[model samples]
Target: MSPQKWDENHPARILLLKEMNEGRIPLDSNEMGPAEVYYKYHSTVEFQVEGMEYNSTFTSRLRRLREQIRRDQGKPEKATKTKTARKKKDVSLTWNENHPARILLYKEIAEGRIPLDEKEMGPAEVWCTYHDTLEFQMDGVEFNDNFATRLSSLRAIVKRDQGRAANDRKALEKAMKNHPVQELNHRGEPQWNGSLAQALLQQDMAEGKHETMRPSELWEARPEYKEAFSRKDDFRWKIRQEIRTKKYLYTLEYRAEEKLRKNLKKEGIVLPDQDEDLDGVMDLEEMEDT
Candidate 1:
């Protein structure tokens, strides 16, 4: 990869901020001006703004950036209630960039060697495939059981993040429908509430905010509905469903492990002695915790 060049579009300010956040630039930046701090750590990094001389303009530019950061930090809670939606952070940022396994995993992903689609293969399967790759061997990265766990975690984070935007959009739409920005009509005339707004507000306060539901009212209205849901079968069915899911997951993990073991054996890597199999080590209490 070519060394990154900083200009007007991609300022050294961004890199400076990132380094500060990650504790890489641990200098007392507030005391020392941005220019001094930047030059201290990133002395070799030549940053220049368009049509602006670096010696004269860079300090002023950094001052503006700092002021902007301060303004953002000092923003009031109510200031965020504006119609404009905030930018969401990328889901990939949740993973540690410096992680040995993740660095290789992301490289493979970028190279189109490893697909990010978890629907096609499980996390363990992905790790097993990743293990046998030339990139993994060339990097001299050793096997770790937690690689599979991290893959699963990252997949879950991505899935959850993907759903969040849709959920936010739905919520915004619902909110717009319920309480519009302009309550007045096209003619700028006062609209009739008909006590609906107040009633809705009261209902929201009770049900949504406080979660105060009237079970007795529902039971009286539909006795069968309550009886059906309250049955022991419903509770037992959930437990059975969870058991099935765990069993399926364990099976996938076992197969992935077996495949990895065989690959390692082929590569002349010593296999670690295992005291027990997955089934033998399965704890009822641990299953319940899940």
Candidate 2:
């Protein structure tokens, strides 16, 4: 691990933005894989962030790194959702960036052109504002309000995932507690804490319930093992499915918490204990401060 060598205009991040703009890297979870960008491009900046590897460093901090670059330049955080404050601090998205409509929407909101509670605005409105409703392509995809919405969702997921992974422990703990299967060894014998719990669970799913089993007898066990046996040749898919499920559940919980906070705020009840990031994104590190 080394200290971060990044400032507002670090070449590492500049290269990343270049890669992002060039379509070499994608924002969708569906596109995650062993990309050339991960190996070739990521190496250029892997030394900047401490302990983060070339493969994971960028995807893990997709949104935050950009925001960090902005902050390092002495720019203010994102604009306020509050109409009154928004007037004082006109926020903006990068005009030359891929997601220009999002900036336009925020600017519109800041200018009081749209109500805070306004229903979803159409993508056509974005096209109309920018190009007289002319259809266009951006990053090889049709540019419309739907793309804007997807951009927001992807950004949200990136931000949420980039936050401390520990913040998601509640969901993991719930799974471990509520799971019908208990810890078991490869042989199916029960093992206590300090063992490889995940491997044990996979084995349990493979063999079903068994009071007594041995690692040597694994092949002779039942064929209906749901976890390990079913996905024997598809370990990658299993891991991806588990990761996606975990992220989805964690995101649902985060959204619910956001809703509760908003409702409480209307009643003049600010939960000081749950101060989100200045940008209104809840970084797990920030959440744990209180």
Root-mean-square deviation of candidate 1: 23.6
At residue 242, give the lDDT of candidate 2: 38
Q: List model 1 lDDT by residue over 1-290, tens digit each.
A: 54344443465667656655565643333334433443454433434434323333555655555555546567332334223222211111223654435656765554546556766776666756765442243223444555566666666555575579789999999998998766554545333233343333334434443234343333333443333335434423433444455566676566555655544333223244465456623455654655
Name the weakest run of 10 consecutive residues (lDDT summed) in model 2: 132-141
lDDT of 1: 0.48
Each model's C-alpha lDDT? Answer: 0.48, 0.45
Q: Write the per-residue lDDT of candidate 2 for residues 1-290, one digit (tens) a residue.
A: 55566555556667776665566654332233223234344445433456434333454565565455556557565553456434422532223323334444444554546333324544455444544110121122346565566445544544455454566787788887888556565656444334453455455644542224443243235332343333343433444343444455565567666654444333222333454433434455634542
Per-prediction TM-score to the true structure, in the order listed = 0.23, 0.20
Model 2 regions more than 4 Å off: 1-227, 230-233, 275-290
Clashes in each model (backbone N, CA, C under 3 Å)?
A: 0, 5
